[model samples]
Target: MKLANKRPFVTTLFLRPILLLLTLIGNYTGICKKLNVAAAELVEAKAVCATRLRLRLRQAQATATCIVTLIVLIFAGAGTAVSVQAITPNQAIDGLQQLAAQAEENGSIRVLVQLDLPFRAEGELETDAAVQAQQANIDGLQNMVLEQMADTNTAVIATFKYIPYLALELDAAALETLAALPAVVAIEEDIPVPPALSSSIPVIGADAAWSVGYTGAGQTVAILDTGVDTNHAAFTTGGNRIVAQGCYSTTNASYSATTVCPGGVEEATGAGTGVDCTAVVGPTNSKAQSDCGHGTHVASIAAGDDGGSIVGVAPDANIIAIQIFSLFNSTTYCGGFSNCVLTFTSDQILGLEHVYELRNSYNIASVNMSLGGGQYFATCDSDSRKAAIDNLRAVGIATVIASGNDGYRDSIGAPSCISSAISVGATDDVDNVASFSNIAPFIDLVAPGVSIFAAVPGGAGTKQGTSMATPHVAGAWALFKQAVPTASVDEALAAFQAGAVLVDDNRSGGVETDLARLNINNAINSYVTGLSVAVTASEDYLLPDDLVEFTVQITNNTGSVASQVVLTAPIPQPLSLDAALLSGDAAVVDGQIVWTTGQTLNPGQSLTRTVSFVVKN
Candidate 1:
């Protein structure tokens, strides 16, 4: 400072300049540190942003895949739903129409609906196709469509869930409702006898006896007709005769034309069947009793035991009776033309449902339907009658029906014409075709149906009709089942058909040609081959009663047969025991019993017994 007074002025200026330079250096270092910290923060933020973007892209891609899968599943489900709806409704209705038309052309007014579908449209179009075609377009459950039909001038009637009742005793409200339909040509409560019986007697050839061998004893045959005479000597006890019994009464006796068995006992009613109210357990008829004894006669021919002079195809076959109407009313000919003409399709459907139950509940093998509407078709449908046939066949149950009493050449009746059923025609003892039997291409085979003697409710009597003939085939089928313990339904049918001989020319023309011939043993073999398991029943006992009873000891040889196997034996008529009680054990598990009954030994066991039974009075 002192030097500045003389020569220090320059030194002081230089020191001030150095202090200024140091201050500038300190400010620049602070700025550099701040810049470095800001750049590091920017780099971290950029890395986080890139990671977030990648996560969002992955989420979007996953969402898109899920959406695509859901769409595909939804489309597939919609397509299946549409397909089912289409088949159950529109398609089913169309199919029914086609079936109905075919029936009408074949002279049948009845149609069947076997599936779970409303049948209102069928009743509406009873007479006019155009009206039905138009009405059928309306939804089956549409109330507006129903109202429109009420106001229409067309003669189309519609009925649903109806049961066949005799003309005089059907529900008035139901009948009235059906009658009021605009398209209703007529509303009939009377359900005719199934195509089981023919208006005319059946004529079968002598070969029928030989065919009897095929029917096995112990096979059960169900008769969905009038009540049978279980007490008849001609019927086998525990044999091929009356295995079970049932009856139904759906009509009043005063107005019904049906006749009851000779006993004059009205079939029990109130349950829609002709059954004995007094008897709690027995084979009951689903219909009413008949006064004409038509059911009795038909049943006798179908499964009567092989008596000295009277023998049925499957005498050992048991029968299950199901009466549709009362045959005991003198005022009504329930078994005659009136009962046949007044029959409706609805009644038959219920009868078939009962049959299904019987097959399942009782293990019934065959069903004999001697009743049906006079209709036929090349194809099948769900119309009322067809419904029953289809349902019966679907369950592996065999149905035998009479062609019809109608003498129309080239025409067959409903149920009879159904391909799944065995349509039988009446033949004479000489194997001649009956004139009244409906001659048609659909006819499967001919059997003895004319002037056949059978058991009536009261006593034995002779009757003629294809109804009698239908039972013959049924009994034979039962025997076939017995012969071949392990036979399948289709195989049995084939073998039965194979044994049948065709009659090309009418009996009067004297042209006899064997179309097909079936033997009892041969049919049995064929059936065994068609089954999934082998049968091992090997006990044989000749049981002679009004019904033929055959006892056999069996073991599951191949372990393929069902645990509850059925045993069948074929017996012949004119059966008698010549020796004293001969009881011996054939094997530890099997035994033979030969007993001499009260009757003289005129009839011998040596006779080739197909189904043997004693004729009961």
Candidate 2:
């Protein structure tokens, strides 16, 4: 029989009412038929009716499932008319189309169109052939739209294979047609992401870490921003620190290791030239040089060399500068923040893809993104950006991002709002949250971001924003990675969180914000070195003026060596340490046995010392 409606009637709402009505009708019929019978027979008939009604209800529920299955089968048979929610355009795409329509200008707008692709589990390895096949599918779909646009005389700007999307310039009139394509799942306006805009490192205890010799020597931090200054003294480690650079902005030329752009000069000169050499190449405007000096400042905060005055959080870590923003022109204003800096999500995505590609060459431990725009709530709305971040993190790179400078509650922007990224807010030198820094539940850590001094393109300068705070955490990650090369992003994050200093006061509005401030020394001491000490007395009981011996043992349980280890044992009450009885570099000072000259403890190594104390009644 033909169904009354074409729509599926499998929902419980439609079936429950019908089932209840049937039960009611059955009960009524049973009562009417039983009224003529004896009292015992009528009671039995009522009981039997209840059992039949229960069975009918269960059968109705099962029929609903079958109806749902039938609906699916019917839709499958209908071919292209089947409605799939996964391929439908989301609200962000609709919003962008409306925005495009409202624009008075008649120029083509750049948009990112995302496609629904097969799901890949975290860390799942796909063979080169498989990857190329998947990319071919995406490219084929993209080419279809490009061909359609070619007929209408529109240009395709760029295609992305890393995240199943394409960046293209499309006219307002063509947006509706393009969005209606079956492969297109989302289309968002490519907005400009401005630089968030560092700090006193000592406030975060980087000095202590440095003093202990964990200077992030073997680690590399990738900076994705406007660019870095290769000539800057901060990055100049005799051509050893600045390892690689590339320009991913659409305005600039494609990837080049030896040349920054088409005719740009190589940063390094000499025998180890061109192939596999440690030199960065990009346009002067987007390379190690900066007109706004934002990227250079951020680079200095993360891994700049130590000058006499200013030192970076990870002084010895190498830098891989990826310029995602081209030189800003007059027309490109980043939401009125500044006229000189602008970037797009497509550029950022390209930068992330490049980072993943160069992961093996650079062995990058942490990535610092001190730039963001467009406030996004709890989760990242852009699938391409989120997927890129996840892929980088899955490969062991710690992605640190700034929680925007909007100063609004829960206004952390996209990429930063992404759950996997280490979202960092800004605090003043005194551990108070910065007024301009965004506050949200996702903020993982806060660092000194007010009037922070670091290496600018011209010279050392000071700037402020959550941007400054982000590199501190990135630099800390470098240090952590240096200590534990095998640690994952989550492991490093947990270490930082476990070692962070809780700041219950000094926030804005005098309200108690429960965020932990960065404490690099605590991170090193607690997580990196894994140093522990235990003390035990030779005898538990002692009489008046009795002699007692105490032993102290310190162990290093990590994979790295622990240096500058010192033990301080306070003389218990009613006890006094004898200077003459001290042994193994131990001395009595002010009723305490102090190991002034610290010893080095190798991995899985322990050191013990003995001292004698006199008990006084």
Candidate 3:
């Protein structure tokens, strides 16, 4: 087997060493007998639990420092499980003990059930026919499980079509019934995920790619967050950049929050449904207004373009927007804040499923999810979102996530902590890891995230966090996908890691892990990018002698430099464009604007030239 191009950054993951220590605490009859250090090892393992306490402090302090809300669902039920009901062994999955306690206290708990059988993603079932058959088998098993648990006091939230998992709001009896079934594997709480954006664009060398070309044209990136501001110029370049949109939010009385999707129901899909975070009204907070723009800011950082004024990582890449957040207006669940922008784990999975479904249709290089919660010291391969993320990976879509802003020294958040995800931490312009960025050993990459200026609800704003850092890498993933369509997730990540500039944690007493910071120009070997220029008229069909407006858009695709560039084209009538949009005043000769100065357009840089002309008036 060829083993050369594997990602060294993660190939030597700290998971193995941590798991080795964990195994001793669980079952080590022979090892303990042989080594005779079981007591000391157990003490060490218990000390590791201190890290968990630090995580709580980090989350609790967010009310003052940041807006990353960690939601802990309130326990409410009729009584304890009827007669100490049996719980299937789910020791491998974390948080079950807490769920059991909650169930014991309330007699009801909502948990995610994972079946042993996969929804056709586990093995080598490549062909369409094989995949379909596997899916049918999965459906049959899930139906059987549902039928068995039908008598218990349970409500089904949702089920996965490609991943073998189900979100169920059930009582203790139902939990017992579902866990006992032979097909059932593990059960975990569907914890809430907090909204987590942008940056110094040229610091990462995105402009170099624009100089040549390769600005993520002819591809799409899925944004699974609160929602995108599609009306913003960052998204509306020539036409609507959001090629597709979907909504997956749930209104649960458990959190005193309602669904963010339109119709006030659980799920919906269509145009304008993926609007900016302004969907929620009647709420006010110092953080609420800016937090509402989280989705838009994150999206803009990844692939936003605004008539040459501001550009994202992949300026021309289309977007598949999925609003996965729910509006929590009650201060009870808003961490004492007036409102909270959050999403459930199941909602994130739904967004991933939507992206996977569109993999064949669109050149979806990556899915950017700048939301996460919970904390894990080790790789969370058994996380509820892992299946959906792995499903997307099988079809060649990278799941890029923010490493969280908790400022923990040795831990990242839940979904990003999952092994398959390309977790990104935040770095400043000087390549120093941001003080607040999580620095877990499992983190995949870091990018510029300090005071990143990107599109917000009504205008542009600057925000700093790992959430901002993730999109820079996500946009870079789109560029890599455009450059090498067939590259696997690992391959693309490896390419970036291979070319990345190394940064160390100089923060006193920080995690000793050395991290790779994003430097696309260095990583792609050469700085060649693709460029795209577009021209559009405000109204295609205007009556004679009517005033018309023409739009000329020139986007730096990818590459280093395009010499002797001419940015002029034939129009119905002679018209002049806004000089601010273009890079230079070219040699205007023969009714054409020829750019004579050797200009350098950054990768994903866009220049929009607008001209309003009176055709015959």
Best by TM-score: 3
> Model 2: per-residue lDDT, tens digit, 473-550?
999888878777788888778777766766643544434455778987766665543766677887878887677776
In model 2, the worst 10-residue window by lDDT is: 268-277
Model 1, 302-395: lDDT tens digits are 6665455556666656667666543333213344332232333444455555666566455456788787655564533323455445545655
lDDT of 1 at 540: 51
- TM-score per candidate: 0.49, 0.67, 0.70
The CA-based lDDT of model 3 is what? 0.71
Sort by TM-score, top down from the best: 3, 2, 1
What is the lDDT, from 0 to 100, of the residue 383 in candidate 1? 35
- Scanning candidate 1 in windows of ten residues, the lowest lDDT window is 600-609
In model 2, which residue pairs have backbone atoms overlapping below 3 Å? Answer: 198-452, 198-468, 228-288, 229-288, 260-281, 260-282
Q: How many residue pairs clash in each candidate?
A: 135, 6, 33
Q: Which portions of model 3 miss their true places by more than 4 Å?
A: 1-97, 104-107, 118-124, 197-199, 276-282, 286-292, 526-617
- Can you give the lDDT of residue 48 in candidate 2? 43
For model 3, give the 10-residue run with minimal summed lDDT. 67-76
Model 1, position 164: C-alpha lDDT score: 17
RMSD to true structure for each model, in Å: 27.8, 15.9, 21.4
